[model samples]
Target: MLFLVLLGFPVFILCYMLAAPVFGYLGDRYNRKIILGAGIFFWSGVTLSSSFISELYYWIFFLSRGLVGIGTASYSTIAPTIIADLFEEGKRTTMLSVFYIFIPVGSGLGYVLAAGMAGLTGDWHWAFRVSYSLSPMGLSHSLWSFVWSSLGLTAMAFVTGALGMWVPLFLYRAQLAQGTVSPCLQETCNSSNSLIFGGITVGTGMLGVIAGAEAARRLRKINNKADPLICATSMFISALCLYVALMVILIAFGELFLSVNWAVVTDILLYVVTPRRQSTAIALQILVSHLLGDAGSPYLIGITKNDCSPQWSFRSMQYSFVVCAFVGVFGGAFFLLTSLYIEEDRKEAEQTSPSSLNTSSSSLKEAIFRV
Candidate 1:
């Protein structure tokens, strides 16, 4: 059981990194919401089907998990893009942080649920049984047939997947046809005047600023002096603290917390950046954060565990996390201040660079020449 649990990390890394971007491409070319919804719906089905497996069905179980991986890949890629579409820059980081709080909490709960189920039955079989039995009826279709039935079911699955692909295309055409501008596009227009625009230059940061500004605006409408700057600052700080707490939980009980943490973190990162750049942002974040921040922390801990003591390994990692806590807090603060800085920089550039400003103005006029 311990080996199975330990093995899942590498498996997750393999499947997640490889499969997620492919689904993301489908989402980008089609429709983000549809892709996300289908991904969720399909993964839920896969989770449900896992309940009935025995050793005889172990291969089937692996295949089902692979399918689930693909589905989530689509969702993880698109969800962040959707959030970016909906929110602004300065607030994007905070909002993403808040959204990510679920990763740790849900993972904690999943373990509790698994343990409770196993304890109640005294057999692991019931865990899968309950999962499959409780899952929606649609997923059971594959189980009802045998030998010859596999071909028909495979064909059916293909048709369903293709249909799922089309839903996004229809939604994209509808949104664009209706002249509903994406929130990111709207921000590019209003950003010149917004304080949040001064912070980060990336599309993700832009979405955060727009979202934060809208939230601040709503608050101000209710209270005369509701300074968005102060509100954003506070939220980002609080979120950073929450993230640190989660990291402590993960490092302290690495065995149990890792899988769910991966799922949750991917979801949060996806939500922070824009839809168009979801795959790139997620991939980049994975590559960079793992490379720079915590990538080697686990290996370092394992070496200590073997060389010194198990307790020592965990203890050493905890000290490292102390530093991470500071980084998280500082990172949030940095995002808020950066957005304001970028907005100011753009304004200064427009004021100082007459030729460049003129070129931009002329291009804008040409694009909107009719208006």
Candidate 2:
């Protein structure tokens, strides 16, 4: 079961990484609503099918996950581009923040829902069925909300991928290192730890989304090019918080700080890209971010943990997290650099907008009539 759980994430992420570019291209060329709807339907159908899988055929479950990844890739790449087309400036940032808040909120709810359903029914399959039933409602909502955000995302991904995969183990090791035995020796203790983590994640994530959006909106009032500055500053602060969390004992604070980074980056990406190229920009962001981020971090951390001497033991995971903190610094630097060019890009894109061109033509026609 452990092996399956570990292996499934990479397989799904790999399929998502591969399919994103193709779907992104299609999104630019086709009716985005149709593509988005089809993706939601396909993923939901596959998710429903998983509830029926027999215990004898476990491989089918993995396959279904991969297929679901492909389906989600279509929606993930295109939906944000559609949102970008629908809004401009601070309004776009606000909408994207609202869109992304659901990510952590849904994740927390999933864990709670699954646990509740399993506890009530004494069967896990019912949990899957309940979730599968809700897919259509999400699909019914207009497709909404990624992107330059990719650099920060890649950095953020590495941090999250490594931390998420290893944090429980690190906590267990910390318990041992302190030479204090507690109730954490039981499996239930691990579940409790996970629930605590999820609560913090959801709470901080929603706060960060709202706070970041409002901050960006205020910054934009001061300067139109302020989005990238918000991203850069948030990322740098997040990196500093991660470093402190690594050195100290306050992991929850690090998680809280990390939550704000995504909102800022998403605002920056949409603010800079032209509507005509938003899909392709988002696709590239997804591809680059995952390729460098989650796709390899789990394996990388696992190998790092294994390679360390026996004396270091589980402390090896801590060392791996240190690497992630430094990577956060690198991500911050990328966003800082992006701030320098983002204004120029936004200006160039605006100059090429159809409305601007039409206005220029109208002026020319008036001058000719006067002549």
Candidate 3:
């Protein structure tokens, strides 16, 4: 059943990855705000309607997830381009940090709200429905930005996907193994793990985003290579943090480092890819990242755990989690590779941007290097 639930995420990602190119092409040629707005509506409606589904037709829920992906496609493909157009240099990076911070923040909040409401009401469906009551709402790249950054992000996604799906369960199992908690025999087990996990996610995510943006802004003054380097360093440290599974403090630090990549990576995309092609670049980045990244992470972790299981499921899961650490190292390496090309890509992007008219390539390169 956990495996089945995990499958929907990859399915949604696959749909999201595949649909992004279409939206990318459209966004480049059309009005992006309109497309973004339309997508939000489509996404919201589908999500809201899915809450009403009955267990007899649970499969339809998966289909709705796929539809949700299409809606996500438009926003993912185009929204960053809007930001890129609006801001420049350090300002752009800061704005983007604010933008991408919402990814984990939303996830963290969703987990808290859904779990709290469900626990209080004793109906899981109400968890999904609470969003309607609460109201509110609301990649890719040039080759260097797309290729290296996406490679890095893919690993981040992989680790995030596995951890996101399994951490609560893993925590529960750990306590059980220690004889600190009893095994849950109820159909629905009430536990504080989700609440604690959600709080950690929100806190770590918020702090990480703020710290990363400030670090990048300061570092960029001296180094043309700061963004990718920051990403590389964060990925490496995150790998270390993730390897120490039993320490929740280490896990929090791991999440902090992981969150650092969100904005930095997007900022990398904006500077390396031209605005005209940004939508497509963003789309392609999403495609490659999700295709290779979170799309299969949770499912792969699940199967690996299942295969390794003997008497203790927790031990097997711990073994499966080791994979995430290695992947994080590879992600860091990809960013190092990115540093090789970022300076050249930034100049090229500047030359081709809409505002580059009448500017010489030499002048553009000079301005980029000065930054």
Candidate 4:
């Protein structure tokens, strides 16, 4: 149970990582203001409620933390994209830098908020309650794209979500099948799969991000649609590696390919969609990714395993994981399709983005004055 408490941070991260993409998809398709506002509202409510949890229900604390991550994900994925639309080239980069400055400011303010609240109220729970009361959160302005989503990245999300949660367990089940490990009904089973997998995830995540970014940077000098091409290529290779992930090294390679597109996909949406719609496109991409990917993949895999064969756990999971390979292929194919339309879309975006922003900015004022 203490270990579970220790896992709170990791749980928050995994939830944030998984939820960010889903929220990204949402940002692109829905009312940006509502989603952003709802996320902040949800975050504050959950955090405040969590403070009321009793000592006996520690798991709820973890659950609340995870929910908070999901709520924050909306802002994380949507805010910058909206900023991208609001500013022109000369000021865009500067605005983004300024926006990120809030990270440190918020972090620092949080410590003060918590400390001050706890000291004044004489209880940690009041810290959360007071902090929630003080938060001012919401957004105004709304607009609405599908081209940015070939659902390829969502496929990657599915693959990673399932693998991240289940690979170690799958390996342990494999060992059990091979009779290399004993399964005790009432005793804790021993295994190093989790630790080993964690190391690989950390190492390959860094390497993949760097490799993808560098490759895309070099390739874009010649190809305007380089982002999707790189994404497609990586997904294809990742699919192949994960299809044969029975080998330990193949898992590492699969993760490497999967990690390469984190930033690249957002880049694609930024250029493909018009400025007024960029926020919606980016947020929707995130929504679809999490909606189809990490948010459900584990359960999908687990249920398939159970339904396939109750008695043969290892074989069932083995077959279920194969779904990820096919999804990866589908994801790669989506990226390929994205490559076809990206150039045209980007051209359209460049031509209209400025005018679109100008029109949108005047819309609310015009309506108000007309009233």
Candidate 5:
């Protein structure tokens, strides 16, 4: 059971990685709405079908999850391009933030809904029925959500994938190191800590999104070139926060609270890419980031942990945290580099827009304000 549960996400992500580029290419040349709608319908049907399968059959369940991933790839790859096409610059940042706010919210809701349905029906399979029913409603709405969030998603995946994956165990070991061994030993204590962690993560996550958007909006008002600047600054701060959180465990929550804002910073960066190639660019970004970032973090961290001497078992995971901290810094530096090119690229994109040809001005002043 444990192995199957662990196997599910990576298989899903693997399928997602494989399918994203293909779907993204199609989305760029065809009707995105149709692609997105088909994706939702296919995934919903697959998930609904899964509920009928026996829980004892792990391989079939894994295959179903992979199909879900392929179905989702269609929606995830192209949705943000749609959003980018609908809005401009600062407004795009704000809209993207609003759309991404649902990620953590929906994640939290998934936990609650699953738990509630499991309790009511006394079987986990019934939970899929509820998800299948609700998913169709998402199909009815515009499929523009989350891909712009991919920038932040990549960064968070790097950091959280390395550190957050082991947080509970880290906490347990930390307590053992402090000679206070009972903290994680109690089921209630563990559950309470899990709840607190989830609550803080979701709450701070939404706040970060809102705060980052507003900060970007205000900075843009002061200077047209502030978008990437804001992202660079936020990512730098996030790196610092991760370092502090790792070094001083007592302040870990406070640091995590600050680090959540990095999501907003990275999200706005996606909008800075060329608009015509947005889907392809996004698909590439997704591919590289996940491939280089979270996909290997867990395995890397596990190897690091095993390489340590048995006497240093408690500290093995802390070494992984240090790697995550440095990665956060690298991500920040990448954003700073992006800041250097964004303004010029943005101007070039605006000039190439169909609306630009209809107007008479060669200056960006006219192009920037076009609807």
Candidate 6:
């Protein structure tokens, strides 16, 4: 258990980070659809490969897990960019919201599927095998003493990867030219002035709720239209309400906290990324969330377990999920508010500086607003 905990999460994060850039680059340089298709194909293949190991060969398992991370990361990065490419920003969040509704359901089904497969075969190994085999068809296959999903996914990967190579060149040319149209010309978030201002602002804002409130108040004073305070306040209130709802549901319905969080977070991400990147955005969101969120959580739990009683350590770690749930609720509300503020700010600026709108890239702007 310790070995699995230690090895699993870091590899998940490392591979996630490594692959995200590749996907991002691919989305930028080529057609988003092809990148997304390839990502799906490769991710499924690696996921199936993971089930093939008979022994706890840590390195081999690590490598296979890494491959899974790579495929997933690539998909996330590319998918979001694709959505951004196709959709207008105003409707992106609603579209993403619809897309994200699947995560919780999918995760829950995964657990059931794993358990059912294990029961049918009377061997844990068969669970992974069944997972791999069933994925290509998106179906639950017949019972078997031994089955391997890795082979099926690998086959799919080969086919998808080959087909992806043929995606149109015109799309790349169009995106490249689009980058120069107007929004891309706006100052990058990474510029020197932005770095200093953004860093300090974000840091101070995150330090305490009061700081964020104060900042919001100042913005509202200046613009009379900015509602940062209301956004922050709404988030706090909504989080409290959700906490009560969660407690009720957990007690009454016996719902798992992690499963619920997975559902909530996924929906939030889809809502935010959809208008900007559609299905491709899902890949990028997964990469970032896994690379930083779950990766860090597991590592922290591992460290705690090492120093303390394992039972207490695990319990404490589980408690963190409750905190995370509230954070997610709050974070979502805050982002909505921030987006409103940004839109208002942009509209005001656009009235005076119409040319600035054309100089910016929608992709870049969407990323900023979403973040």
State how far residue 69 of model 6 sits from its true place (Å). Answer: 0.7
Index of the highest-TM-score prediction: 3
Model 6, position 200, has a per-residue lDDT of 28
**Each candidate's clash count:** 28, 0, 5, 21, 0, 32
Give the TM-score of each candidate.
Answer: 0.47, 0.88, 0.90, 0.65, 0.79, 0.52
lDDT per residue for candidate 6 within 118-208, as digits (tens), equals: 4567565665676677654201121010011111112212211111111111122222334532334322211222233223223322232
Ten-residue region with minimum lDDT total, candidate 2: 138-147
The candidate scoring highest on lDDT is: 3
Q: After superposition, how far is residue 232 of candidate 2 from its true place, in Å?
A: 1.7
Which of 2 and 4 is the better model by lDDT?
A: 2
lDDT (C-alpha, whole model) for all candidates? 0.41, 0.71, 0.79, 0.69, 0.64, 0.41
Residue 129 accuracy (lDDT) in model 2: 91
Candidate 1 C-alpha lDDT tens digits along 1-371: 33443333334444655776576556556777877777777877777766666656556666666666666566656666666567654455455545544433333334344545666776555655565454333011111111112222122222212211221222222233345645345322222212111121122223333444444445545642233233324334433543454344321211122111222233233322333445555544433333333323333323322244434443543443343334434433433443343333334433444445678899899989867
Q: For model 1, give the RMSD to the true fold.
A: 20.8
Candidate 4 minimal-lDDT segment of 10 residues = 138-147
Q: How accurate is candidate 6 locally (lDDT)?
A: 0.41
Q: What is the per-residue lDDT of model 3 for residues 1-371, given as tens digits with 9 covering 90 to 100?
A: 34435656767888899999999999888899999989987887888898887767868988988998999898878888898888877688888888888878877887788778777986666765776555445021346655877788889888888878877777766666567666653224324777777777888888898888999999999999999999999999989988885434236888889898888898888777777777887888888888887888776777644333233776777777888889999999999999998888788777666677546666888899999
lDDT of 2 at 338: 71
CA lDDT, candidate 2, residue 279: 73
lDDT of 4: 0.69
For model 4, the superposed segments whose C-alpha errors exceed 4 Å read 1-66, 82-150, 185-191, 247-250, 304-311, 355-371
